[model samples]
Target: MSALPNTHEVLLRNLNLVEGRPALLGVSDAGLLPECPVPGLAMTEHAGLWQSLAGDTVWEGCYGYEPEPSQGGSYDTVVVFLPKARAEFELRLALARYLAAPGAVLLVIGEKKEGIAGAIKQFSAVAGDVVKVDSARHCQVWSGRNVDALSRFRLADWLDWSRVDCAGVELSVAGLPGVFSVGRLDDGTRLLLETLAESPLTADRVLDFACGAGVIGAWLHGFRRVSGGSPIRVDGIEVQAQAVFSARQTYLNAGVSGDIFAADGLAAIKESWPAVVSNPPFHSGVKTDTSMTEQFLSQVARHLAPGGELRLVANSFLPYEALIRRYVGPVEKLAQNRRFTVYRAVRKTLG
Candidate 1:
């Protein structure tokens, strides 16, 4: 298998810090913080990434947006691993400003291809006088300080909300920068919603796996309401905190009630569902990863009630039909456009 990106190594090697300083790491990978000079607190919304980092004794891990108070009083240094979403990057910067003690150092690291240079300008706005500390292995590290002791950061001010019409139902959707399809509807999800409109699938409970921005779940709720089916309950599982937050806001704004949680795929869910729907994720950071989707296919059987259905939309090129049949049961192609395909699979009866 090809190696994942090496930006973490570059960041670790080039980080300039004194020993024993209390530190906080934001949105980082597995091994990045373990080798740092200071014992650190790491935060990630990705459950799989958290699992990989949980065993490291060098640093502690938190699985959500904010670190618990018991993690430490305050930190002398905070490092943010830049994500692709500009809003999320700003949110992390705001968080770094919030967590770092006055005059404490704040560092940001990312690959040049991921636009580390552009991020420097944004970093300077919140933290003062950014300086490039190191550049190697196609990644650059920049550092600044929280000069203003009285600066207050509010995450709510950073959210972007918009009105969208899906399947003729106007709804409000809100998302922070890093959430998928941040301020608008995605074509793949739109196709899935269209498919749901014509399908005969009905259930009292449904699962929205990989429910980014909560679009699929919220829309499904709306569809079920219009179809006059028995009141349907929706549960959404997302791995990113921002996406989970956005998903919750989407449901709330649309006057829909549902449960959305930050989790690594199906790991945290214990309930078997009558229907499962998703426009599953295929990419992680800058790497093309099908493993997550394949894992979902292989494990979804255990989460489905007898004769339950799994409906998914994917790019036409992914070989999901065979995998769905092998793991879940019989599969059928529901609809396909030039760029996307929708598939439905039924859970088979056990002997």
Candidate 2:
């Protein structure tokens, strides 16, 4: 197998043999459980990571926002593998406060590059006292005790909601901490919307792949209604459980109906569609990687009907054009600005 992540290695090294079971939060597949096998819950939001720990006890939270108690009992220890997003870090800290037993020791581990010191500082707000227990492999492990009452931080209080207007459409977007571009619309998405308006693309069934906050799907639903087009069905697939929740709320706020599922890319989707549109995520944590987007481009053709099209907006610097041609079919640039490019690729029909 592969090596353990630096943060996980540091965490394992510094963790003392505690008396009771410990909860593991945001621990990726590369992270191994303690050799003694604690009975507490191992939780993650990434479906890919959750599936990797198959046969192991793992709980998949909807967007990595909430934590469920183990066997309905409070945990004596809570260990958090810090996330790159500040909002997500705070959310997990809140979970730590909610699930941790009074005076329970909360352990947090993270790479310095991801701001371990800042995380420790944030932990101090809710924790009684936070201190670095160990530092190695460029990662630091901090420990604190839960002194605040559970009722102080509610799950609903962690969500950040706001109204955003995109291309004259007002959106009631609900963003869970750490979800991308949470309460506001991003520039890339705005560019995609502009291209969608000018393009000749029309479909009765559509897939909003990587549908963060369900903005694209909601906008499509509203556009069709105002344009006097036939009623359309939209389905969204997102990797983050929180994004899936936000997408559902976005649809509700817009008075539209759509099916949204939390999945690892298109792994959970089975149906072929006439159109697929996305402003796909290219970052995993603090690393800029195209593996997820590349995987989608390489396999997306199998999920598209003949003559169906895949329209996506991406960073102008990304080499998606070549990948699109290799797997999907001929691709054309629909629009381009200073930083973003929109492309449309049609699936070739077989004779």
Candidate 2 Cα errors over 4 Å, as ranges: 34-36, 52-63, 69-73, 151-154
User: Model 2, residue 114: what's the lDDT?
Assistant: 86
TM-score of 2: 0.92
lDDT per residue for candidate 2 within 91-141, as digits (tens), equals: 788777777788888888888998888878888888877887888999888
lDDT of 2: 0.78
Candidate 2 backbone collisions, by pair = 62-241, 63-241, 63-242
**Candidate 1 has which clashing residue pairs, if any?**
none
Q: In candidate 2, residue 177 scores what lDDT?
A: 78
Model 1: CA > 4 A from native: 1-5, 18-20, 51-60, 68-73, 149-151
Question: What TM-score against the true fold does each predicted structure earn?
Answer: 0.90, 0.92
| Model 1 lDDT tens row, 1-351 | 333356667756765553246555554555555466667777876767777667777777766565554433277877777777656776777777767778887778888988888988888887878888888888888878878533455556667888777776667788887788878888998888888888846777889999988887777777767777666778888888778778888888876767987778786678889899989988877777899899999889999999999999999998988999999999999999898999999998765
